[model samples]
Target: MGFEELEPIFGELNVERAGEGSVPSRRFLYHVHAADPSHLRIIVTDFHSNAWEAVRSIVQLEDMRDNIGIGGSWLEFIDYVLASIKSQDAKLILEGGLDTVSGAANAKLVAQKSKGMPVISISLTELVGSAASAAITNLSLELFKAFKSIHDLYREEKELSNQLTKALAAEKERNENIQSQLEQYSKGKKLQKISSSDKADASALLNNGLENSPEKQTPRDTALTKVANRVVPVYRRARVRGVTLQDTEDIEDE
Candidate 1:
């Protein structure tokens, strides 16, 4: 692809076109410097008549200090690419064709890699022909839409998980409050039982004391008997001073 068309794809990235003599087999070599320390070099080969025929399509990574280094072989580079993708730390994407045998093999490797990350595959053959340019643009747009959908779904899942956690915590707190209330109610019932027992015991002791007393009288009964004895003598003296039955009989005889 021309620099003008590729510029929009790799915006703000440092892009350099390799000299024709640098890699004779490859038609175009695009060296792309990403924002991070790692860089990508995509090597595109001429299209063959047979789609299954092996094309010299290759991808090279530079200064990939965090990943394992590989040799110049296309297979080794594919392995390294997959390894980088699997590592989950890759910041750059180097899309290549999948029509040729080697390119198809690399696509299979990418497919076999673990998920939870995005992988975009673009065919170099489609980019060359004027008729296929529209298809390529559509494919790129679809890839972006897929990435955005995945991002939105991930955010939704995170929000649901957070809400579930909050609900569980609130349920636990409510259960704790209910448990505390139950415990307090149990303690209050126990105290009421103890108070009732104390009252019964006091009544029993008072009854026993009255039954064991010498006169079978409680303290209150004894005090009332003393008052009665003192008032009875006073009443008998007043009756005697008022009139005798013998004096009434003598008066009746006279």
Candidate 2:
């Protein structure tokens, strides 16, 4: 589709066109910002004419734009874009027509670079024919919808994974707390048992002492009672002898 047709669909996006005269051929770049604040950059180029030369020019342009001085084969650009996507900074989609054998091979490499991003592949000759043009348009729309769906699903999956990790951590903490409380309770119960045993032993010793003390002192009490009985009879005899002991002796002699 022409820029006029795609403009309405992606008009809200931040658009930047590269390779007007600076580069050898024409190239367009569109940066789309989603509701989730995630960004997707789409690169449109034609490499069917001179694959190697076009690749070199594209790489140079990219290097200059990013100022990273990246050097390697053309396929390296795909790798760089994939790395950016993996880092979650932005998503990249490569769109081009596969006409020559080199273009097809490069397209395959580009598709492989993207782990899950969609590659929009179209035939250069197809645009000229009216029927093929309609089919391509439909195909483009379907691919865009599919890409959006996949991106949403990926975000949701990441969110769910994070939530599950937090839940697991919370559960582990709760279990640890419960185990600590149980240990404390067990210790308390053991201490109570020890205390009760001590009290029972003391009570048993006290009762044993009480039971044997009376038997141990009974002989001493009996001796004291006998001594008291003998003293009382002597005291009564002294009281009955009123006369002097000498006069009583003389009367007996006479």
Score every model by TM-score: 0.38, 0.36
Global local distance difference test of model 2? 0.43
Among the numbered candidates, top TM-score falls to 1
lDDT of each: 0.42, 0.43
Residue pairs in candidate 1 whose N, alpha carbon or C atoms collide under 3 angstroms: none
**Model 2 Cα shift for residue 207 (angstroms):** 1.8
Q: Per model, state how many residue pairs clash.
A: 0, 0
What's the TM for model 1?
0.38
The per-residue C-alpha lDDT of model 2 at residue 127 equals 22
Query: Model 2, residue 192: displacement in angstroms?
Result: 0.4
